[model samples]
Target: MDAIPYLNIILRLTIWFLLTADLSVANIIIGISIAFLLPRHFASPEPLREWMRVLWEIIIAIPQAYLEAIQIMLRPHDEEEIVRERVKPKRTPGLIFLDIFLITFTPKTIVLKYEEQGWYKVHRVRRKISDQ
Candidate 1:
């Protein structure tokens, strides 16, 4: 069995405990049952390395997002444009969702749509350059 299912269950249980704030035996059982019973859509299970790469990307994006926000604030005069960008070829629904979230989390870019042909229609804002 892949570790992803176990990880999912663990995450669900954590959320359950956090939300219910009850660590009683009955609540533990209920949380475990709910975690297992919850519907999961499994795509052709992505390799563990791929998942790790996505996780690393997410970590890197946090500081990048802060930098982008600072840049946006310092340069208020910006131009917005839509651009098409290629996405990873092997994309699952979870990966696509995460990709969109990462892109949109940054202040300067938002993913408008994911195309059928593995492209992202991205809306981007950049500081406009002017002749001084």
Candidate 2:
């Protein structure tokens, strides 16, 4: 049920990012090539009302997230150990709200990388302190 909405968002983002990054004739060729390689994803059948509710939730969440980014920037980190202190509790994969907070707030300084716990690699992002 929930998975269907998430996939729709992800594919929309993918198409947007690709389109924004390139618009040349070659880009269209690459897009066509990608269409062949892409697998058909199944979205569970869900009610239209449920879908509308999910879409509204997503719309509201985006601006609040950017506001959080502002707050993270306004608040200062205590020290280097703070990073280690922050992530100690999680036993499984997927970005926590704060992890997404950092990524959203500081996209320039962060990078997402694959991590393996077993057969599946959980998505994680980390920020590097840079020397300027």
Query: Would you list the clashing residue pairs of candidate 2?
Result: none
> Which 10-residue span in candidate 1 carries the lowest summed lDDT?
3-12
Q: Write the per-residue lDDT of candidate 1 for residues 1-132, one digit (tens) a residue.
A: 787666557757976998999999999999999999988877786677776787689789999999988887887846889999888988876667668878887888999999988999999998788889
TM-score for model 1? 0.74
- Local distance difference test values of all predictions, in order: 0.83, 0.45
On the 0 to 100 scale, the lDDT of residue 111 in model 2 is: 24
Whole-model lDDT, candidate 1?
A: 0.83
Clashing pairs in 1: none
Lowest lDDT sum, 10 consecutive residues, model 2, at 79-88
Error of 2 at 53 (Å): 3.6
Model 2, residue 104: what's the lDDT?
33
